[model samples]
Target: MNATVLKFGGSSFRHTEDYHRVAGHIADRLATGEGKIVAVVSAMSGITDNLKEVMLNVNKKASPSNVDAALATGEMISACCLEAAISRLRIPVMSLNGYSLGIRTNSDFGRASIESVDPKQIMAALLEHDVIVAAGAQAIDQSGRLTFLGRNSSDLTAIVIASMLGEHACEIYSDVPGVYTADPYLVPGAQLIPELAYQTILQMSLHGAKVLHHRGVHYAEKHRVSIICKSLTSDGAITGTIVSGHGNARSVTVARDSPVFSCASLEECDSLCALLARHDINVLRLEDSHGVRVCIVSDIDFAQRLVSLADIGPVFIGLSNVVTELDSSGLLVHLVGDYDGAISLVRQIHEQMYPAVVSVPFGASV
Candidate 1:
């Protein structure tokens, strides 16, 4: 039989009614003999927040050890609840925790890296059971310390499990129907993009798109796992974003000598670097200028980070034109390339508007 891994977000299994719905969904899928199914679950809605509140109340500055211990309750509660619900269907279900299954990770308390998963035990449990409910977002480190896999870590857990199982696909059920060109709530006209390259999804997530966590996508891409982002509550057709590996698309390289914007404080610079790294943005060159750091983006998108850096500190003080007010936020207008036509258009604009002579910068093509 084929294998499939399904991850349910906290919002989907928030209450008893939601649990019943999830159970029914699973039952229906099982009845069809679709495949061997593994269900990964996050804590019910608001449970993590409540747990964090308790931690803060006891100690405003809780140590990493205390925080992981406290934060783990959420996923534990979720796993137990899911197991109980699945039991009602009389399906041989097993609930596995990170510690019991020997899914080891790094020492990071809140955001641990999964070191390895003992597939033998996990596969044995799956072969003997109808459904296996595993706690999401929590993993045991090499030192046996409990670790929480940061926010949206459940997605990572599902992808990892699917990769280990050699499953054909990983289905991530969430509140949204699918991925949209823009946040549908913010931009009502945002259209749903049925298919997108993994790189595009990475770029979208980096640029304020909150559909899927970046780490989850990275794991899926690396493991060659096909992902489907669909709704948990609806039997509605598979209506969500599908993330796949990079494909053959025309490659266009634009070089530019524009003034690069950068942050000053080392702490702020590091934070920016982390943020860019999380988004998989590649920095071509980084240099220090009079104590300020300048990062050039040869590849990957850094336009959004540039604007954010500008807002925090480090205004553009380089030779490039101060077109900061351009509507092209989170977008790079390549300024280097053979573009006589672009220069002609700039001259036309300059003729229209006096004083603000549009400078084409020789080979500029923004």
Candidate 2:
């Protein structure tokens, strides 16, 4: 009835050998008497996109249900790989996919919202195994069809597991150890935020920070589950930031690759926005002399599906990047037409808010 919940993102599995490495880490944790653990896993890097490309190439008009079935396989394969690695380490381990995860959602396919979670199966399995690897970002619908929660949503899966099992905290491992004032890779001056409030992090995610999924943050906040952001390294696990009820920081978020569409009329844009919101998609509306432009920063494919479903004749205006700065005053959004400009603006804003640390050694002064 008691277990620790952890999640490993795609970046953790860049190569096949990384699976064994993660399994070794899990074994090491067990050696430290961490007790039974539930490790949620995402698809190997680029595999989901590859799968989607192959599926779409074969059938451009495939139903969303079928697409979900195809995309869900990536996580299932990862679960199997990690399970095998753990078993090779002479550990009692099992893996579960959407079919048996006991988490149910509506038939929303690409961005399904979790409706109910029955932890009996997971608990029963834990009684027989020390580790249970649950495929993340996937659940089943009422009709028992596979459903993908959303892109980069494995975080939600991990948090949901922790909440259902009555755990107060969960660990999420990614390429970056924790959240930063700006993307560390792009902005050399970016500083790692040691702690952040639930709402603060949630806004960052909503603006396309990529550190965590917004839905997952919302769920964690609602369930009062603290999120421990960490990264596994050669030395060991490094805890970067903890997200709970308190803490605040000024940060800049840049969503470099977002799709934008031009609606013929304001009414059409409004209708499309409402439709997308119902499916839990975040949209930014911009009005100009030409028409209404709607930008979708996350779940682009699902947003396209919704647009198609609505039969709105919105012209594709191509991708527009978003750079946002959040501080004590408020959030300021900047829409850039090019990636270079977005990156430049991010550095400029990051430098202004985190000025004193810009000259210090990267990743050291913070």
lDDT of 2: 0.91
Which residue runs does candidate 2 get wrong by more than 4 Å? Answer: 359-366
Report the C-alpha displacement of residue 24, candidate 2, in angstroms: 1.0
Candidate 1 TM-score, C-alpha based: 0.70
lDDT of 2 at 151: 89
Residue-wise C-alpha lDDT for candidate 1, range 114-154, written one tens digit per residue: 77877777788878888888888888887787888776678
Top candidate (TM-score): 2
Compute each candidate's TM-score over C-alphas: 0.70, 0.97
Candidate 1 stretches greater than 4 Å from native:
234-237, 246-366
Please state the error at residue 247 of candidate 1 in Å.
7.6
Which candidate number maximizes lDDT? 2
As for model 1, its CA RMSD to the true structure in angstroms is: 11.4
Colliding residue pairs in candidate 1: none
